[model samples]
Target: MAKTLDELLTVTAPVDLPSYDSRATTGFDGKKADAEKQLTQLGEELSNLQEKLFAGGRSGASPTRVLVVLQGMDTSGKGGIIRHVAGLVDPQGLAITSFKKPTPEELEHDFLWRVESRLPQPGEIGVFDRSHYEDVLIGRVRQLATPAEIERRYGAINDFEKAFTDSGGILVKCFLHITKDDQKERLAARLDDPTKHWKFNPGDLDERMLWDDYQRAYALALERCSTDHAPWHLVPSGRKWYRNWAVATLLLEQLRALDLSWPQADYDVEAEKTRLAGM
Candidate 1:
């Protein structure tokens, strides 16, 4: 049987990160090098499979839609992963959305209203940079909602995701796990590099002060919302390369499981040749 999201989350460390020095090698550590290599090979195979699945398919048999929701704190490598791993996917069938602070209209509506409007159509993949989970994660962490309100959203989110999955969409939620120390280092690097200075926002520094609160929020979100259909994976994100590989591997694995093939059709070569000759 396949592993449940809850089981995966339980097995994952709440706050552990791979050592930065260890990332200099191919694997996370020497112990997982072979496994990592295998995953990379699998990712490449999956990429090829995805390409084949999208080719020569028309109205009758549409490919399965994949929805990947990526959520994390400041300085998390969300943009990097999207640029690298998802960049490998066929651009024609993929959609990427990055959610920032709510606009006036969005703030007036329910949190999920905007998200629902952006769902992937058949044969397409939608990637959410920050998703509806924010209603529970950041909403709770920032005390934007009351305890009862936060609790209510937990069930609502689960049901919403269940509906998406039941309707033939595959949902994968990844929480990019990065350490505070690493985040500081990355943020500093961004400031030091002139080209990256534009990426820096002073607001991120404020969020860093509430690191523990965010962690607690994430733990609860993981504990409550991880379901069999849409599981959340905590990607150790200090190493941007490993993070990209892991995300690409998981996506490839999920997409490979989908039945994405063209329906059989009859063709008349002789009739076509005769018609062409007559013409």
Candidate 2:
């Protein structure tokens, strides 16, 4: 029998990224149709959880928050995950950020500074489309920073994450795992359609050439940064349907673990109802 998602995922340290199957779909034994049905149900549950979580925080019922960090190579369906999973939540309760090449102002600050400023507020779900992991992944691959600087960043990232989690934040980092072949197909599909041409960047081909280096960088980052406070989940993204389902499942699992409750008003409800009824 195939393994469960928890077994298939890489949440613990000592991870061997190369050994992880990008094509993994070991848990669910369903076709696209079945996965879609499950995704619909999961979406409904997630919507409810998001509202309650948001309400709890907004009403001072809870201080808990959530942050989802998504990192992957180009054409890895990060956009799709946003539209499918995070899109299910109420806009008021959702916070989304897409990290890109740093600006002059951003470069002046510590790498994590910008990210820290955008964390989810209490009872909110914050999604980082491409998070600080870029510093280690692309920074290492493209030699944007010195080797010593890169090494220092690993420690800095761990400390930042520890502090964040200590503050009632549930951090879930997911690395969308897709094969080189999958990327090629995705890129090709985009090219074959004029509407998607906007998504294509010539520089992506340049980065594709350095795929091996990026892979190594990711492997090192995952191994070094995976901690009990916040762990990494290597989500197989070869199949779009399965990828969406797995990521959605992960989000639902984390939200359920919070055990959040609807906040109750302190005033007497019966008396308030009677008074309002008289008016």
Candidate 3:
């Protein structure tokens, strides 16, 4: 069985990270290795199941849809997870969209408009790199909204998600949790490596300076938004390998539960076989 959101978050660490300003760097190398092995096995099983679903003509019949939202700070492996996990799904039935700072036209619409416009149709899996939660997370953290406004938006988001679930969409939201120390190390690595420099934004360091603020914002976001229908998974991401495994495992578990089936065939297989043989 897949780990429930509560169970996954309840597993105590050897050292509790500073709730507000974490600079801790305890490695989970052993756990990561184990997770990697488990992920490999799970990945194979998921691939096999997906192939059966597609080959059995199930893709067109049941038309189940999944929406996976990944949200975290800069360089939290959101892009990497998208590249790997979505690669496992059928390319023909998947859509991946990355949200950045709003464009001029997007600024004219409500926060959820851009996200709602990108929702996948039936039988498709849609991956959002950074999602509407940004409004709650960054918007609140940056004090872009009043407390009253934030509270109002919280209920709005809940209702929005409920509507999706009611309409046959499976929603999975993951918050990639990484320590400040790990983020610092990643930032440094990006600076040293020429190829990765493009990913290093000075603004990310600016945000790092307000790391404590971000954590508080995240804690509240998780508390407010995590629901019975659309819960949040806080994946420990100090280690990237473990992060990938955790996400892949969660996705595989959810997809496996979806019991996809093929449409009924109109013609008899025996008749078709005989007709083909004669030709």
What TM value does model 3 have? 0.83
TM-score of 2: 0.94
lDDT of 3 by residue, 1-279 (tens): 854433454323222335522222222335656867866776787676665554443335554567888988887889888876677666776778999888989878878899999987776678899988888878888877788888888888999999998887888788788887778888999999999989898999889998988877777777778888888777777667777776776676677777655557667989999999999
lDDT per residue for candidate 1 within 1-279, as digits (tens), equals: 865322443223343333322233222343455546765676567667666555523343654578888987877888987777777667886788998777899988877898898888776778999999888877987888899989999898999999999877888788887777878899999999999999999988888888888878887888788777877777767676667776776677677677456545556878888999998
Supply candidate 3's per-residue lDDT for 152.
86
**Residue 239 accuracy (lDDT) in model 2:** 91
Stretches > 4 Å off in candidate 3: 1-7, 10-34, 51-60, 266-279
- Candidate lDDT scores, in order, read 0.74, 0.89, 0.74
Which ten residues in a row are the worst by lDDT in model 2? 2-11
Error of 3 at 265 (Å): 2.7
**What TM-score number comes out for model 1?**
0.83
Error of 3 at 7 (Å): 4.3
C-alpha RMSD of each candidate structure in angstroms: 4.2, 1.9, 4.1
The lDDT leader among the candidates is 2
Q: After superposition, which runs of candidate 1 have C-alpha atoms over 4 Å from their true positions?
A: 1-44, 52-60, 266-279
Query: In candidate 1, which residue pairs clash?
Result: none
Best by TM-score: 2
